[model samples]
Target: MADRVVAHQGAACWATLFTHAHYLPCLAVLLQSMRACQTRYPLVVMVTETVDARTRERLARMGCVLRDVDAWRVPHADGSLAFERFQNVWTKLRAFELYEYERVVMIDSDMLMCHNMDELFDLPLERGMIAAAFACTCNPKQIPTYPAEWTPRNCGYALRPHPPNDARQLTKPTYRLINSGVVVLEPSQEQQAEIHTFILRHTERVAQYRFPDQDLLADVYRDRIQMLPWYYNALKTLRQCHPDLWNDGEARIIHYILDKPWLLGPSPCGEHTHLHSLWWDAYASLAAHPATLSMTRDEWANEIALHVRGI
Candidate 1:
């Protein structure tokens, strides 16, 4: 057994990645939430060259440690680049490269932390036990393939044949698919190298998955992952699908899945609408700060109008 002392010795940090300028407001809101909750760990943001100097400056002003990383390009079966499918998500893989920290909790900029979830860092980290919450199951009505009958208990794992040839069969049932919006991982140079190699080795196969990073990470960690309670990644969809578990006061995190609150018009009634109001409250808190007052009124108005007018 690896010595617990050595395995858990280094500092833990909070990290997030965004490749575009449009996400800056959301990132600011997320960072504000972290500060509001008084997170104990350092915060880091990974950006590609696409993020402009102004945005970088703002992020720096927010006390975020900014790191530049390259976006990953998808490759063809013949070892050539596939331009159409080029993804910025590959930047998230760099979380494993954060060797300075023993463990990194990667949160997506689209999420809001309702409470201080520093307790997640205390969970066991042996054998790369990535801690994450199950992604909210899709509405079968919206997605025909995913049956409405499917519940968390029955839908955690499905037996799908391995790609490139369905000859070998593997039957290991693990927790349902995890949402990559928030992830807890212990950085390891060896694991980082292994993940890189795995991506390169299965480049063609990777193209087939809906979400490359989430699918790849889930496939790699499967049974090894530690399942956090649903409150950790309480998706907006849960309010409609599983109201029994959707308690705003108790949820540690609220993930703005599919339709982001910042991009939606006000609805007459719905749980998601309530959550959207909360998101605006968080945004307001950040925008009202004297340091962040320079954030243009036009930017805020435009965001609201775009959503209100259904643009």
Candidate 2:
């Protein structure tokens, strides 16, 4: 409930990524929700050259500081050093390079803020601390090895099988993976250098991970991470797969996972309809005049192709 401007007093700010023009609507809604909730810190967005000038102007008009960064990539899994399409997810790691900010809480553009989460800035974060909520294990039935007694405290590692004759398996430590959607990071020159070094040292392993940023970060900071309460990042999957854990009143930020309400119409049944309605309501209020920047049919096809390639 505290609305203190702690981040501004220090060097921190709220940051997110704007990689593609198609994401403009989501970013607009996210910014609108942040303003509606009266967030205390300035909102900064990291963008690549691919983002159009008009979108950049719109973001600036919305009072967001725009930062231009080069797109980054990791090697392909097959030990092939071929460069994949630019992945915005990899760009999330650049948050650590904003040395001007002592700390930053990176929120995905797909998220909607229901309350002023300034309290996140007050949470104790050590030099290497990465704070985030545990990704909802809503479909436990699908995970064959999921323990019936699973709780955040006892769920230390989730095993990943290695190929036969892979001696590298002995060096890897399995750790619980945290969702990268909402993360509290303390950015420093040293931390940035460390991440860069890590990427260079384990480029092959990073490329093979299903979720690059999420997996690599969890691997590096697994021991230093502090798990936040689920209310901080209530995943929509919980509402769809595990209704028992869904409570709108307790949720401060609703993250639309696999399915986004903006792109898809509301479902006909269940409480998830209400959650989707919330997203539409925010979108309708903020995206009255959506950005003109849009992908062409061929560009859209290319984007789909790139996604299929998992880059």
Cα-based TM-score, every candidate: 0.80, 0.76
Write the residue-wise lDDT of candidate 2 on 179-231 in tens digits: 78899987778777877888889876776665567777887876666767666
Worst 10 residues of 2 by lDDT: 156-165
Model 1 CA deviation exceeding 4 Å by range: 1-9, 76-86, 144-154, 157-174, 265-271, 290-311
Error (Å) of candidate 1 at residue 180 is 0.5
Report model 1's TM-score to 2 decimal places: 0.80
Off by over 4 Å in 2: 1-9, 78-86, 137-175, 266-271, 287-311
Indicate which candidate wins on TM-score.
1
Worst 10 residues of 1 by lDDT: 158-167
Most accurate candidate by lDDT:
1
63-160: candidate 1 lDDT, tens digit per residue: 88998887766543332222223356667878988888888888888889899998777767666568777655545336443434445444332222
TM match of model 2 to true structure: 0.76
lDDT against the true structure, each candidate: 0.68, 0.67
